[model samples]
Target: MRFVTDPELTPELIDELVDCWTDVSNAGGSVGFVPPVTADDIRATAEAAFARCGDDDHLVAGFDAEGRVACWLILGDAGSWLRAHWRWVLRVMVHPKHQGRGYGSRLMGAADAAARALGVEALHLTVRGGTGTERFYAGLGYVEAGRIPKAIRLAPGDDRDEIYMVKSL
Candidate 1:
Protein backbone atom coordinates (compact mmCIF):
# COMPACT_ATOMS: atom_id res chain seq x y z
CA MET A 1 0.00 0.00 0.00
CA ARG A 2 1.15 3.56 -0.76
CA PHE A 3 0.18 6.35 1.57
CA VAL A 4 -0.24 10.03 0.78
CA THR A 5 -1.06 12.99 3.01
CA ASP A 6 -3.08 16.04 2.06
CA PRO A 7 -3.84 14.54 -1.30
CA GLU A 8 -5.81 16.57 -3.77
CA LEU A 9 -9.57 16.05 -3.57
CA THR A 10 -10.28 15.11 -7.12
CA PRO A 11 -13.74 14.00 -8.11
CA GLU A 12 -12.54 10.45 -8.55
CA LEU A 13 -10.92 10.45 -5.12
CA ILE A 14 -14.12 11.73 -3.56
CA ASP A 15 -16.12 9.01 -5.25
CA GLU A 16 -13.70 6.34 -4.16
CA LEU A 17 -13.79 7.61 -0.57
CA VAL A 18 -17.56 7.68 -0.52
CA ASP A 19 -17.68 4.14 -1.86
CA CYS A 20 -15.16 2.95 0.72
CA TRP A 21 -17.06 4.70 3.52
CA THR A 22 -20.30 3.14 2.41
CA ASP A 23 -18.82 -0.32 2.23
CA VAL A 24 -17.13 -0.05 5.62
CA SER A 25 -20.24 1.31 7.33
CA ASN A 26 -22.41 -1.44 5.84
CA ALA A 27 -19.85 -4.02 6.92
CA GLY A 28 -20.27 -3.02 10.59
CA GLY A 29 -17.28 -0.73 10.73
CA SER A 30 -17.74 1.94 13.40
CA VAL A 31 -17.56 4.91 11.10
CA GLY A 32 -20.07 7.75 11.32
CA PHE A 33 -23.00 5.88 9.82
CA VAL A 34 -24.85 2.62 10.45
CA PRO A 35 -25.21 -0.31 8.12
CA PRO A 36 -27.27 -0.34 4.91
CA VAL A 37 -25.91 3.04 3.86
CA THR A 38 -25.53 4.11 0.27
CA ALA A 39 -22.83 6.19 -1.36
CA ASP A 40 -25.27 9.08 -1.42
CA ASP A 41 -25.67 8.73 2.31
CA ILE A 42 -21.93 9.22 2.79
CA ARG A 43 -20.95 11.59 -0.01
CA ALA A 44 -21.65 14.85 1.79
CA THR A 45 -19.69 13.85 4.85
CA ALA A 46 -16.80 12.48 2.79
CA GLU A 47 -16.58 15.70 0.85
CA ALA A 48 -16.69 17.66 4.06
CA ALA A 49 -13.77 15.64 5.36
CA PHE A 50 -11.88 16.30 2.18
CA ALA A 51 -12.48 19.99 2.67
CA ARG A 52 -10.85 19.83 6.08
CA CYS A 53 -7.46 18.99 4.64
CA GLY A 54 -4.97 21.89 4.72
CA ASP A 55 -3.12 23.95 7.31
CA ASP A 56 -5.47 23.06 10.13
CA ASP A 57 -6.16 19.45 9.18
CA HIS A 58 -4.83 16.53 7.20
CA LEU A 59 -6.18 13.70 5.10
CA VAL A 60 -4.01 10.62 4.91
CA ALA A 61 -4.97 7.92 2.47
CA GLY A 62 -3.51 4.56 1.52
CA PHE A 63 -3.91 3.18 -1.96
CA ASP A 64 -4.04 -0.40 -3.20
CA ALA A 65 -1.80 -1.85 -5.86
CA GLU A 66 -4.32 -0.68 -8.45
CA GLY A 67 -4.06 2.90 -7.20
CA ARG A 68 -7.44 2.88 -5.50
CA VAL A 69 -8.09 4.27 -2.09
CA ALA A 70 -7.88 1.27 0.23
CA CYS A 71 -7.74 2.98 3.58
CA TRP A 72 -7.72 6.51 4.96
CA LEU A 73 -7.96 8.70 8.04
CA ILE A 74 -7.93 12.37 8.97
CA LEU A 75 -5.85 14.31 11.45
CA GLY A 76 -7.62 17.46 12.58
CA ASP A 77 -6.39 20.41 14.56
CA ALA A 78 -8.13 21.20 17.82
CA GLY A 79 -8.60 24.81 16.75
CA SER A 80 -7.25 26.08 20.04
CA TRP A 81 -3.79 27.14 20.90
CA LEU A 82 -3.92 25.35 24.26
CA ARG A 83 -4.73 22.07 22.54
CA ALA A 84 -2.49 22.46 19.53
CA HIS A 85 -0.07 19.86 20.80
CA TRP A 86 -2.46 17.11 19.77
CA ARG A 87 -4.77 16.36 16.87
CA TRP A 88 -7.99 14.43 16.50
CA VAL A 89 -7.97 11.40 14.23
CA LEU A 90 -11.29 11.09 12.45
CA ARG A 91 -13.14 9.19 9.74
CA VAL A 92 -10.87 6.19 9.81
CA MET A 93 -11.97 3.69 7.23
CA VAL A 94 -10.51 0.76 5.33
CA HIS A 95 -12.24 -0.55 2.27
CA PRO A 96 -13.93 -3.78 3.34
CA LYS A 97 -12.14 -5.72 0.59
CA HIS A 98 -8.86 -4.43 1.94
CA GLN A 99 -9.45 -5.34 5.54
CA GLY A 100 -7.16 -7.95 7.14
CA ARG A 101 -4.52 -6.97 4.58
CA GLY A 102 -2.75 -4.57 6.98
CA TYR A 103 -3.83 -1.47 5.07
CA GLY A 104 -5.46 -0.03 8.15
CA SER A 105 -2.25 -0.31 10.11
CA ARG A 106 -0.27 1.18 7.29
CA LEU A 107 -2.71 4.08 7.05
CA MET A 108 -2.40 4.72 10.76
CA GLY A 109 1.37 4.55 10.71
CA ALA A 110 1.30 7.09 7.93
CA ALA A 111 -0.98 9.31 9.97
CA ASP A 112 1.40 9.01 12.89
CA ALA A 113 4.28 10.08 10.73
CA ALA A 114 2.24 12.94 9.34
CA ALA A 115 1.35 14.12 12.80
CA ARG A 116 4.96 13.94 13.89
CA ALA A 117 5.89 15.97 10.87
CA LEU A 118 3.51 18.63 12.06
CA GLY A 119 5.28 18.57 15.46
CA VAL A 120 2.28 17.08 17.18
CA GLU A 121 2.79 15.37 20.50
CA ALA A 122 -0.32 13.20 20.71
CA LEU A 123 -3.29 11.85 18.78
CA HIS A 124 -6.88 11.53 19.95
CA LEU A 125 -9.59 9.34 18.50
CA THR A 126 -12.96 7.95 19.48
CA VAL A 127 -14.56 4.59 18.80
CA ARG A 128 -18.01 3.35 19.54
CA GLY A 129 -18.11 0.60 22.09
CA GLY A 130 -18.97 -3.02 21.13
CA THR A 131 -17.36 -2.66 17.70
CA GLY A 132 -14.02 -4.25 18.63
CA THR A 133 -12.29 -1.14 17.34
CA GLU A 134 -10.81 -0.66 20.76
CA ARG A 135 -8.58 -3.63 20.34
CA PHE A 136 -7.45 -2.44 16.95
CA TYR A 137 -6.43 0.97 18.26
CA ALA A 138 -4.85 -0.57 21.31
CA GLY A 139 -2.66 -2.70 19.11
CA LEU A 140 -1.51 0.51 17.47
CA GLY A 141 -0.23 1.88 20.81
CA TYR A 142 -3.34 3.84 21.71
CA VAL A 143 -4.84 3.62 25.20
CA GLU A 144 -8.25 4.32 26.58
CA ALA A 145 -8.19 7.82 27.98
CA GLY A 146 -11.87 8.15 28.81
CA ARG A 147 -15.38 7.00 27.95
CA ILE A 148 -18.80 8.54 27.70
CA PRO A 149 -21.27 5.95 28.89
CA LYS A 150 -23.94 5.12 26.34
CA ALA A 151 -23.11 8.21 24.38
CA ILE A 152 -23.91 6.95 20.90
CA ARG A 153 -27.48 6.08 20.16
CA LEU A 154 -27.72 3.93 17.08
CA ALA A 155 -31.45 3.40 17.42
CA PRO A 156 -34.19 3.09 19.97
CA GLY A 157 -32.54 1.64 23.07
CA ASP A 158 -29.50 0.57 21.10
CA ASP A 159 -26.85 2.75 22.62
CA ARG A 160 -23.12 2.29 22.77
CA ASP A 161 -20.44 4.00 24.77
CA GLU A 162 -18.23 6.52 23.04
CA ILE A 163 -14.73 5.48 23.92
CA TYR A 164 -12.03 8.14 23.88
CA MET A 165 -8.57 6.92 23.03
CA VAL A 166 -5.25 8.69 22.87
CA LYS A 167 -1.73 8.01 21.70
CA SER A 168 1.20 10.02 23.01
CA LEU A 169 3.91 10.49 20.47
Candidate 2:
Protein backbone atom coordinates (compact mmCIF):
# COMPACT_ATOMS: atom_id res chain seq x y z
CA MET A 1 0.00 0.00 0.00
CA ARG A 2 2.78 2.44 -0.91
CA PHE A 3 2.06 5.63 -2.88
CA VAL A 4 4.76 7.08 -5.12
CA THR A 5 4.89 10.68 -6.31
CA ASP A 6 7.09 12.32 -8.90
CA PRO A 7 6.91 15.90 -10.14
CA GLU A 8 8.88 15.04 -13.23
CA LEU A 9 7.35 12.86 -15.88
CA THR A 10 9.45 10.45 -17.87
CA PRO A 11 8.57 8.67 -21.07
CA GLU A 12 8.43 5.41 -19.19
CA LEU A 13 6.11 6.85 -16.57
CA ILE A 14 3.77 8.34 -19.16
CA ASP A 15 3.53 5.05 -20.97
CA GLU A 16 2.68 3.24 -17.75
CA LEU A 17 0.01 5.77 -16.79
CA VAL A 18 -1.52 5.81 -20.25
CA ASP A 19 -1.70 2.05 -20.29
CA CYS A 20 -3.37 1.78 -16.90
CA TRP A 21 -5.68 4.73 -17.50
CA THR A 22 -6.76 3.51 -20.90
CA ASP A 23 -7.47 0.09 -19.46
CA VAL A 24 -9.62 1.52 -16.71
CA SER A 25 -11.60 3.83 -18.99
CA ASN A 26 -12.16 1.12 -21.55
CA ALA A 27 -13.48 -1.10 -18.83
CA GLY A 28 -16.20 1.42 -17.98
CA GLY A 29 -14.42 3.10 -15.09
CA SER A 30 -14.53 6.87 -15.16
CA VAL A 31 -11.13 8.43 -14.53
CA GLY A 32 -12.02 11.55 -16.54
CA PHE A 33 -13.35 10.31 -19.83
CA VAL A 34 -16.05 7.90 -20.89
CA PRO A 35 -15.69 4.22 -21.62
CA PRO A 36 -13.79 3.05 -24.71
CA VAL A 37 -11.19 5.74 -24.13
CA THR A 38 -7.97 5.77 -26.06
CA ALA A 39 -4.32 6.16 -25.19
CA ASP A 40 -4.21 9.64 -26.72
CA ASP A 41 -6.82 10.89 -24.31
CA ILE A 42 -4.86 9.64 -21.33
CA ARG A 43 -1.60 10.95 -22.75
CA ALA A 44 -3.10 14.38 -23.11
CA THR A 45 -4.16 14.36 -19.47
CA ALA A 46 -0.72 13.20 -18.39
CA GLU A 47 0.89 15.98 -20.35
CA ALA A 48 -1.29 18.56 -18.65
CA ALA A 49 -0.66 17.12 -15.20
CA PHE A 50 3.07 16.86 -15.86
CA ALA A 51 3.36 20.36 -17.23
CA ARG A 52 4.80 23.18 -15.10
CA CYS A 53 1.62 24.92 -14.07
CA GLY A 54 3.29 26.76 -11.20
CA ASP A 55 0.98 25.03 -8.78
CA ASP A 56 0.93 21.75 -6.92
CA ASP A 57 0.46 18.91 -9.40
CA HIS A 58 1.71 15.46 -8.54
CA LEU A 59 1.62 12.04 -10.09
CA VAL A 60 0.73 9.79 -7.19
CA ALA A 61 0.70 6.11 -7.97
CA GLY A 62 0.55 2.78 -6.17
CA PHE A 63 1.94 -0.58 -7.16
CA ASP A 64 0.41 -3.94 -6.60
CA ALA A 65 1.99 -6.94 -4.91
CA GLU A 66 3.19 -8.03 -8.33
CA GLY A 67 4.87 -4.65 -8.91
CA ARG A 68 2.21 -3.48 -11.31
CA VAL A 69 0.61 -0.06 -10.97
CA ALA A 70 -2.77 -1.11 -9.70
CA CYS A 71 -4.06 2.28 -8.70
CA TRP A 72 -3.35 6.03 -8.80
CA LEU A 73 -4.86 9.30 -7.59
CA ILE A 74 -3.91 12.88 -8.36
CA LEU A 75 -3.39 15.12 -5.32
CA GLY A 76 -3.22 18.75 -6.30
CA ASP A 77 -3.94 22.23 -5.05
CA ALA A 78 -6.39 24.85 -6.29
CA GLY A 79 -3.80 25.95 -8.88
CA SER A 80 -4.50 29.57 -8.00
CA TRP A 81 -2.60 32.16 -5.98
CA LEU A 82 -2.12 31.46 -2.27
CA ARG A 83 -4.92 28.96 -1.94
CA ALA A 84 -3.62 25.70 -0.46
CA HIS A 85 -6.04 25.04 2.34
CA TRP A 86 -7.61 22.17 0.38
CA ARG A 87 -6.29 19.81 -2.24
CA TRP A 88 -8.17 18.49 -5.24
CA VAL A 89 -8.52 14.76 -5.81
CA LEU A 90 -8.59 13.64 -9.38
CA ARG A 91 -8.17 10.48 -11.44
CA VAL A 92 -8.74 8.18 -8.52
CA MET A 93 -8.63 5.06 -10.62
CA VAL A 94 -8.10 1.42 -9.75
CA HIS A 95 -7.34 -0.86 -12.66
CA PRO A 96 -10.43 -2.75 -13.77
CA LYS A 97 -8.60 -5.97 -13.08
CA HIS A 98 -7.79 -4.77 -9.60
CA GLN A 99 -11.23 -3.53 -8.57
CA GLY A 100 -12.95 -5.10 -5.54
CA ARG A 101 -9.70 -4.83 -3.64
CA GLY A 102 -8.86 -1.90 -1.39
CA TYR A 103 -6.23 -0.43 -3.69
CA GLY A 104 -8.24 2.74 -4.27
CA SER A 105 -9.00 3.16 -0.61
CA ARG A 106 -5.39 2.62 0.35
CA LEU A 107 -4.25 5.17 -2.18
CA MET A 108 -6.81 7.66 -0.94
CA GLY A 109 -5.88 7.10 2.70
CA ALA A 110 -2.25 7.64 1.95
CA ALA A 111 -3.00 10.78 -0.01
CA ASP A 112 -5.17 12.07 2.82
CA ALA A 113 -2.42 11.45 5.32
CA ALA A 114 0.11 13.09 3.08
CA ALA A 115 -2.10 16.15 2.67
CA ARG A 116 -2.80 16.28 6.38
CA ALA A 117 0.93 16.23 7.04
CA LEU A 118 1.13 19.34 4.93
CA GLY A 119 -1.50 21.06 7.12
CA VAL A 120 -4.34 20.75 4.68
CA GLU A 121 -7.79 20.69 6.21
CA ALA A 122 -9.90 18.98 3.55
CA LEU A 123 -9.92 17.37 0.13
CA HIS A 124 -12.33 18.04 -2.71
CA LEU A 125 -13.18 15.67 -5.55
CA THR A 126 -15.86 15.11 -8.15
CA VAL A 127 -17.32 12.01 -9.70
CA ARG A 128 -19.31 11.40 -12.82
CA GLY A 129 -22.98 12.24 -12.41
CA GLY A 130 -24.64 8.88 -12.92
CA THR A 131 -21.97 6.40 -11.95
CA GLY A 132 -23.06 6.06 -8.35
CA THR A 133 -19.45 6.83 -7.52
CA GLU A 134 -20.65 9.38 -5.01
CA ARG A 135 -21.67 6.54 -2.76
CA PHE A 136 -18.20 5.16 -2.77
CA TYR A 137 -16.73 8.51 -1.87
CA ALA A 138 -19.34 9.02 0.78
CA GLY A 139 -18.32 5.73 2.38
CA LEU A 140 -14.85 7.20 2.66
CA GLY A 141 -16.31 10.14 4.63
CA TYR A 142 -16.95 12.42 1.65
CA VAL A 143 -20.10 14.49 1.62
CA GLU A 144 -21.95 16.12 -1.20
CA ALA A 145 -20.91 19.69 -1.72
CA GLY A 146 -22.75 20.28 -4.96
CA ARG A 147 -23.92 18.73 -8.19
CA ILE A 148 -23.98 20.05 -11.73
CA PRO A 149 -26.40 18.46 -14.14
CA LYS A 150 -25.27 17.40 -17.58
CA ALA A 151 -21.76 18.39 -16.82
CA ILE A 152 -20.43 15.36 -18.67
CA ARG A 153 -21.43 14.29 -22.14
CA LEU A 154 -19.81 11.34 -23.84
CA ALA A 155 -22.06 11.21 -26.86
CA PRO A 156 -24.64 13.46 -28.40
CA GLY A 157 -27.38 11.71 -26.50
CA ASP A 158 -25.41 10.75 -23.44
CA ASP A 159 -25.16 13.18 -20.61
CA ARG A 160 -24.56 12.67 -16.93
CA ASP A 161 -24.23 14.80 -13.86
CA GLU A 162 -21.08 15.92 -12.12
CA ILE A 163 -21.17 15.48 -8.38
CA TYR A 164 -18.77 17.42 -6.22
CA MET A 165 -17.75 15.91 -2.91
CA VAL A 166 -15.60 16.90 0.01
CA LYS A 167 -13.94 15.12 2.93
CA SER A 168 -12.55 16.85 5.98
CA LEU A 169 -8.98 16.09 6.86
Candidate 3:
Protein backbone atom coordinates (compact mmCIF):
# COMPACT_ATOMS: atom_id res chain seq x y z
CA MET A 1 0.00 0.00 0.00
CA ARG A 2 2.03 2.91 -1.29
CA PHE A 3 0.66 6.33 -2.16
CA VAL A 4 2.33 8.27 -4.94
CA THR A 5 1.75 11.89 -5.92
CA ASP A 6 1.73 13.29 -9.42
CA PRO A 7 3.39 10.31 -11.01
CA GLU A 8 4.59 10.87 -14.54
CA LEU A 9 1.65 9.74 -16.62
CA THR A 10 3.19 7.22 -18.97
CA PRO A 11 1.09 5.84 -21.79
CA GLU A 12 0.66 2.59 -19.90
CA LEU A 13 -0.57 4.33 -16.80
CA ILE A 14 -2.98 6.37 -18.84
CA ASP A 15 -4.38 3.22 -20.36
CA GLU A 16 -4.91 1.66 -16.96
CA LEU A 17 -6.58 4.76 -15.58
CA VAL A 18 -8.79 5.01 -18.62
CA ASP A 19 -9.84 1.39 -18.28
CA CYS A 20 -10.80 2.05 -14.68
CA TRP A 21 -12.71 5.14 -15.70
CA THR A 22 -14.63 3.32 -18.39
CA ASP A 23 -15.47 0.45 -16.07
CA VAL A 24 -16.73 2.72 -13.32
CA SER A 25 -18.72 4.92 -15.67
CA ASN A 26 -20.45 1.96 -17.28
CA ALA A 27 -21.17 0.65 -13.83
CA GLY A 28 -22.64 4.08 -12.95
CA GLY A 29 -19.99 5.70 -10.74
CA SER A 30 -20.56 9.16 -12.32
CA VAL A 31 -17.19 10.83 -12.22
CA GLY A 32 -17.81 12.55 -15.58
CA PHE A 33 -18.41 11.92 -19.24
CA VAL A 34 -20.44 8.91 -20.28
CA PRO A 35 -19.79 5.24 -20.93
CA PRO A 36 -17.89 4.16 -24.06
CA VAL A 37 -14.99 6.40 -23.11
CA THR A 38 -12.23 5.38 -25.48
CA ALA A 39 -8.65 4.65 -24.62
CA ASP A 40 -7.47 7.31 -27.05
CA ASP A 41 -9.65 9.97 -25.46
CA ILE A 42 -8.40 8.93 -22.05
CA ARG A 43 -4.82 9.13 -23.22
CA ALA A 44 -5.31 12.61 -24.60
CA THR A 45 -7.18 13.83 -21.53
CA ALA A 46 -4.62 12.37 -19.16
CA GLU A 47 -1.81 13.99 -21.08
CA ALA A 48 -3.40 17.41 -20.64
CA ALA A 49 -4.17 16.73 -17.01
CA PHE A 50 -0.63 15.61 -16.33
CA ALA A 51 0.57 18.78 -17.98
CA ARG A 52 -1.47 20.72 -15.44
CA CYS A 53 0.12 18.70 -12.65
CA GLY A 54 3.49 19.74 -14.00
CA ASP A 55 2.34 23.28 -13.34
CA ASP A 56 0.94 22.89 -9.80
CA ASP A 57 -1.94 20.47 -9.44
CA HIS A 58 -1.63 17.02 -7.86
CA LEU A 59 -2.64 13.60 -9.06
CA VAL A 60 -2.34 10.82 -6.51
CA ALA A 61 -2.38 7.14 -7.20
CA GLY A 62 -2.60 4.07 -5.00
CA PHE A 63 -0.57 1.02 -5.94
CA ASP A 64 -1.09 -2.43 -4.53
CA ALA A 65 1.59 -4.75 -3.23
CA GLU A 66 2.23 -6.06 -6.70
CA GLY A 67 2.60 -2.51 -8.02
CA ARG A 68 -0.69 -2.39 -9.87
CA VAL A 69 -2.58 0.89 -9.77
CA ALA A 70 -5.71 0.31 -7.74
CA CYS A 71 -7.07 3.80 -7.33
CA TRP A 72 -6.55 7.38 -8.50
CA LEU A 73 -7.33 10.79 -6.95
CA ILE A 74 -6.87 14.26 -8.41
CA LEU A 75 -6.65 17.59 -6.56
CA GLY A 76 -6.27 20.90 -8.30
CA ASP A 77 -4.16 23.71 -6.98
CA ALA A 78 -5.97 26.49 -5.17
CA GLY A 79 -6.72 29.25 -7.62
CA SER A 80 -4.85 32.57 -7.67
CA TRP A 81 -6.20 33.98 -4.40
CA LEU A 82 -9.90 33.59 -3.77
CA ARG A 83 -9.91 29.78 -4.10
CA ALA A 84 -6.68 29.40 -2.17
CA HIS A 85 -8.76 28.63 0.87
CA TRP A 86 -9.94 25.36 -0.58
CA ARG A 87 -8.96 22.44 -2.78
CA TRP A 88 -11.26 20.24 -4.79
CA VAL A 89 -11.27 16.45 -4.96
CA LEU A 90 -11.78 15.66 -8.61
CA ARG A 91 -12.09 12.36 -10.46
CA VAL A 92 -11.74 9.80 -7.70
CA MET A 93 -11.94 6.24 -8.92
CA VAL A 94 -10.96 2.77 -7.73
CA HIS A 95 -10.77 -0.12 -10.13
CA PRO A 96 -13.90 -2.24 -9.92
CA LYS A 97 -11.73 -5.21 -9.05
CA HIS A 98 -10.27 -3.14 -6.23
CA GLN A 99 -13.55 -1.75 -4.91
CA GLY A 100 -14.64 -2.78 -1.36
CA ARG A 101 -10.99 -3.12 -0.35
CA GLY A 102 -10.83 0.32 1.32
CA TYR A 103 -8.75 1.68 -1.58
CA GLY A 104 -11.07 4.65 -2.15
CA SER A 105 -10.92 5.71 1.47
CA ARG A 106 -7.17 5.31 1.53
CA LEU A 107 -6.80 7.38 -1.61
CA MET A 108 -9.09 10.03 -0.15
CA GLY A 109 -7.05 10.19 3.04
CA ALA A 110 -3.95 10.78 0.96
CA ALA A 111 -5.71 13.54 -1.00
CA ASP A 112 -6.82 15.15 2.26
CA ALA A 113 -3.29 15.10 3.59
CA ALA A 114 -2.00 16.67 0.39
CA ALA A 115 -4.62 19.41 0.62
CA ARG A 116 -3.67 20.21 4.21
CA ALA A 117 -0.03 20.37 3.21
CA LEU A 118 -0.98 22.86 0.50
CA GLY A 119 -2.73 25.13 3.04
CA VAL A 120 -6.16 24.23 1.83
CA GLU A 121 -8.78 24.48 4.58
CA ALA A 122 -11.51 22.52 2.86
CA LEU A 123 -12.15 19.85 0.25
CA HIS A 124 -15.17 19.34 -1.93
CA LEU A 125 -16.54 16.70 -4.32
CA THR A 126 -19.80 15.61 -5.93
CA VAL A 127 -21.36 12.19 -6.11
CA ARG A 128 -24.22 10.84 -8.12
CA GLY A 129 -27.51 11.44 -6.39
CA GLY A 130 -29.37 8.43 -5.01
CA THR A 131 -26.28 6.27 -5.22
CA GLY A 132 -24.75 4.50 -2.26
CA THR A 133 -21.51 6.38 -3.00
CA GLU A 134 -23.11 9.53 -1.60
CA ARG A 135 -23.64 7.75 1.70
CA PHE A 136 -20.12 6.41 1.53
CA TYR A 137 -18.75 9.93 1.23
CA ALA A 138 -21.04 11.13 4.00
CA GLY A 139 -19.69 8.38 6.24
CA LEU A 140 -16.25 9.77 5.57
CA GLY A 141 -17.29 13.12 7.10
CA TYR A 142 -18.44 14.86 3.95
CA VAL A 143 -21.61 16.89 4.39
CA GLU A 144 -24.20 17.25 1.71
CA ALA A 145 -24.27 20.82 0.45
CA GLY A 146 -27.01 20.32 -2.13
CA ARG A 147 -28.08 18.48 -5.23
CA ILE A 148 -28.20 19.54 -8.87
CA PRO A 149 -31.20 18.02 -10.56
CA LYS A 150 -30.25 16.00 -13.64
CA ALA A 151 -26.73 17.28 -13.47
CA ILE A 152 -25.30 14.20 -15.19
CA ARG A 153 -26.22 12.80 -18.53
CA LEU A 154 -25.37 9.09 -18.40
CA ALA A 155 -26.27 8.30 -21.96
CA PRO A 156 -28.45 9.35 -24.84
CA GLY A 157 -31.49 8.27 -22.84
CA ASP A 158 -30.32 8.28 -19.25
CA ASP A 159 -29.74 11.11 -16.81
CA ARG A 160 -29.14 11.52 -13.09
CA ASP A 161 -28.74 14.27 -10.52
CA GLU A 162 -25.61 14.94 -8.48
CA ILE A 163 -25.10 15.62 -4.80
CA TYR A 164 -22.48 18.13 -3.83
CA MET A 165 -20.50 17.40 -0.69
CA VAL A 166 -17.78 19.12 1.28
CA LYS A 167 -15.41 18.34 4.11
CA SER A 168 -13.37 20.79 6.11
CA LEU A 169 -9.75 20.00 6.89
Query: In terms of lDDT, which candidate is strongest?
Result: 1
lDDT of 2 by residue, 8-43 (tens): 466776677789889998988887777766898778
Question: Which candidate number maximizes TM-score?
Answer: 1
Candidate 1 lDDT, 73-124, residue by residue in tens: 8898999999999999999999889888888888899999999999999999
Question: Candidate 3: worst 10 consecutive residues by lDDT?
Answer: 34-43
Assess every candidate by TM-score: 0.97, 0.90, 0.88
Deviation (Å) of 118 in candidate 1: 0.6
What is the model-wide C-alpha lDDT for candidate 1? 0.91
Cα TM-score of candidate 2: 0.90
Model 2 scores worst on lDDT over the 10 consecutive residues at 50-59
* Candidate 2 RMSD computed on C-alpha atoms after optimal superposition onto the true structure: 2.0
Which stretches of model 3 miss by more than 4 angstroms?
Answer: none
**What's the TM for model 3?**
0.88
Q: For residues 40-158, could you state the per-residue lDDT of candidate 3 as single tens digits? A: 65656666766787456888889889888888878876577778788778889898888888988899999988888777899988887656788888888999999889877766656
